[model samples]
Target: MAHSHDSTALDLPLPARRHQTLALVLVRRLAGHGLHDARATMLALDAGGTEFRRLLVLARALVVDLARTSRRRILLAPCCAAGMTRDEGLLMAMIGGGGLDVHGVLTDDAGCAIAMTTAHALGDELERLATRNDWRR
Candidate 1:
């Protein structure tokens, strides 16, 4: 099932597509939190460049960190609500659903915590993976 001739986002290389998905997920999360203009962020992602790559890396790192604790929802709840915000829940779902596909059962905070810790320990290695040339298109 190769769409070598497709002329859509599907036609993009695998790594590029992965980064695109990552970017979209982050953008939506940020928008939900009212941290940035969704339209502008999307435009920036559409433009795609070194800066976008950096953003993807940072987003990935944040996800990795937050997933580091199942208590994150509880801990961060005070930041904006009585429990996990919609955006936080979405990020957790993303990691659990194969956005990062890190090993372990991400369904629970405990498991997510362990898996994220493993990812965080990789540090620069993760950044290198997220910012590789293939991510640029």
Candidate 2:
């Protein structure tokens, strides 16, 4: 499903789908197994209701996934519009716990660039992961 430019609400078949998609994309850049934990967190959060909970959950999932997979060398290129919150910080902490480094990259000045870059990066990561874990193989 296509995401809106001005909204956090995801257009997905189910909350799980949304969570998985976001998690898969976010985890690819990071360096180790934290992605699995992050995905679980996101799934739980997706079942809850709160202010921007879905978006927050998705963001956290990505952070944790990256941290778990990457060996402490992941940069968080967050959109400026993607305001930082306590949940986000918590997610960062989780990523850090997974032996990954986190750096923040704000993208308020260039929304389009940020969006494109994020999409590309996420896509690349997902593809790499899929290939590495080829279930069909």
Q: Summarize candidate 1's per-residue lDDT along 36-100 as a digit string, tens digits.
A: 54643564465455455545445545544554454423212222232343333443445433333
Query: What is the Cα-based TM-score of model 2?
Result: 0.27
lDDT of 2 by residue, 21-137 (tens): 344333332213343446444443443333234434444444544334332233333322233233233233333231112222222222223222333343344334434445223
Give candidate 1's root-mean-square deviation (CA, Å).
16.5
Q: Candidate 1: misplaced stretches above 4 Å?
A: 1-44, 70-137
Model 2 gets an lDDT of: 0.34
Q: Alpha-carbon error at 31 in model 1, in Å?
A: 14
Off by over 4 Å in 2: 1-11, 14-111
lDDT of 2 at 43: 41
Predicted model with the maximum TM-score? 2
